[model samples]
Target: MNEESNSKGIAMDLLQHFEDILESDPLIDELGFIHPSQFDLLNEESGISCNSFDEANCQSTDKILSEQSSKQENVYFWNKDHKLGISTHILLPLYKDAKHSFLTALKRYKTCSNQSNKDGDCLPASSSCDLESLLMRHSRSLLLLSCDFMTAWNSRKLVVSKKKQHSMFLNELILSGLVLSYSPKSEQAWNHRRWVIKSISAISSNLKDILEKESELVEKIAERSKMNYRAWNHRCWLISYMTREQVIDELKKSRSWAELHVADNCCFHYRSQLMLKIMKDSSCLVETVSFSHMVDIDKAWKDELDWNGTLIKRYVGREALWLYRRFISSCWINHFLTDSGDASHHFKESITNYHDFGTFLKKELCLIDYCSTVVDNEFGDFEAQAMHSASYLLWLKVKVPKPLENELLEKMRVIELKTLVEKSYPERSSLFNYFMS
Candidate 1:
């Protein structure tokens, strides 16, 4: 019993200290802490100032300033350890106080949640709405410390549901975005944002503008972190509600990003999804579409193919562009090149369209040959590049007409390609041999 009382007293003291710091706004010199001039010099060296914490108003200014002070002090200690170094142990008490405050708020929230549950009413009564507000404030504090805390997020959702405040839902989005700015890959934070959006959609009518801005935000995040699968997945989810024109606009914008990031398969996969949506749209059906629209679609596919070819030549060892080529080729054969007939007739026409299919295959083969020759003559890793190019040719060979397959798969060339692959990548010799056979 005495130990419990002592623990309670410590928590109370820490809480008092935290509140004091917030209300007093004590300067560094006033607290007998580091000098103001020294703090300014440290901020200059780190290129970050305590004043910057004011801009991130998502959290309490006191906690944010403490964290910033801790970071700057650590950096200063490292840089000045040889001359006038001071121990950074003073910051430990600040962090401990923050942790204590977080835990105290968490405990209070749990108690409030349990009390509401036990009363058989998840929603707080009008008389106890103040309790709900307090719980929400605690949740916000906890989330600022650990954005992935699902329990705190759930509590906030419950509070919002009970309050039915449209403004609160909007504020939740800002909070989640602040979390994302620090941890871009937090699934829980992203999920909370989605929930907030869903709730807002129930009330707001201007969601189209909001979603467009969201798409742009995801694009910026993708640019910072290549191959962010979650961001790409969110983008795909957003496409279901997009208009045909908006989808086409997004497709055009994404083409340059995909070309610049040749090795990121996520962007290529996203492109394939967008293309499928375009092809499957009712307005794009051959009977309903204008001649000009059909011509535009054909031109887009041709341009994508040419772009993929260029990327393949520029980046020799990348397989993502090759995979994208397969997607584009299959889509083109199924939708654009073949006539809109029965499956058997379409299959037959795909093979017999010498003007289109035959020319495409010949051009692709020439590209492969040119790439292989360049790799052999100029690149230091001849065998690896040769193997990559040869594997692509092998894929193309299977797609050719059976009568011309043997002609395309010349025995001497296959043997030489196999020998180079075996020498360069001996670990996969068995797989290579099996494929060759």
Candidate 2:
């Protein structure tokens, strides 16, 4: 009974050992594991034949060979789960020996990486941690997700010597979506490409080379999806990342491209956003139209009042028109309230269309003589505050000469002095309230 019980115990231990091996073995291409390409270095280059064998051991040897081949394939694809070949087979014996050590390192390293990111070290590190870079101090959490355990280990060995390559691995790991965001893998891929371009070392790679490669990536993605805001945003980021002259040149080139494709608002909106970003960053607003040929609003209609009438009749009923009017008002307030940009041109555009709230108010004030209507009485004071506020800002901007430069200041001063004296109505107090605010 003792011997039988001992035999059963030995069998159970063997069973448990097999189970552990099965669990530890790397995954085979099953389920959602779609292998996009199969260029395994070992499988392609090594000419060792696993097919031929004697009859006695043929079946077992075939199974072993197949498993070994699969493992080899996995390692070379590194992006795929694979084990090292014969040279590293010795390490397999040590796997059990070092299991606890490996697990401890993995846990400690992952925690350290999370802390680093939480500490906001990723931004500065991102410049050096890019795809194709062969050197980075730490792989961070990237090592945990890489399918090729041995390759990942080898890559880490190069961390100190080949900084660029290490960075590149991190970049690839990110693009591979083994780290960073997983839900949007493609986004991570594109971002990784951008990061890699931006990470080019000044010692190893020319700045122009990096900028060109990034521009090419941007154009490639932009061409693939012209409406991709992310691509456009990346392009803008790349341009901003480049030299000052490069930024301006890129802006000019992209602006031309944007204007050529005016059939859709996506490009228009992209151009506007890019221009806004540039203006915000440089604090240099381009007042004059980049393109020489202007769309004549006067020629579009017969007269200024006719243009306003046409605009109101055509678009006043639209919700988009109301939203647009609000947007124009907001833009004016944000961009031109303190007369930050071209004051005259901004006001001219705002007041050009009757659908514009300010223009609408101008006509209404002339008719109402600042008196409250029945609707105003019901709504409690008309809340015509938006219109009144915008008019007063325009008035104050005109009154303040310090906000303007020589040419624009002189031009606006004449306009402001003329309007201030000419318009003396009861609602003039509303202008004072706006100025104070």
lDDT of each: 0.61, 0.38
User: By summed lDDT, which 10 consecutive residues of candidate 2 come out lowest?
Assistant: 54-63
- Weakest 10 consecutive residues of candidate 1 by summed lDDT: 55-64
RMSD, model 1, all Cα superposed? 8.4
Give the alpha carbon lDDT tens digit for every residue of 1-437 in model 1.
Answer: 66555545544443344333323331211111243236456546757554563321111221222234333322212122112222233244433554555556556656767887787665556636666655665565456446777877887887787667887887777667656655677788778877877777777756777678777777877887778888788778777767778888888888888878888898888888888787677333555555556556667777888988888877776778878888887777656544445333433343345236556766676776665653365555445456566666656655554665565555336345665455555677677655546
Local lDDT at 331 for model 1: 74
Task: Assess every candidate by TM-score.
Answer: 0.67, 0.32
Every candidate's CA RMSD: 8.4, 16.1
How much does candidate 1 score in TM-score?
0.67
lDDT of 1 at 289: 50
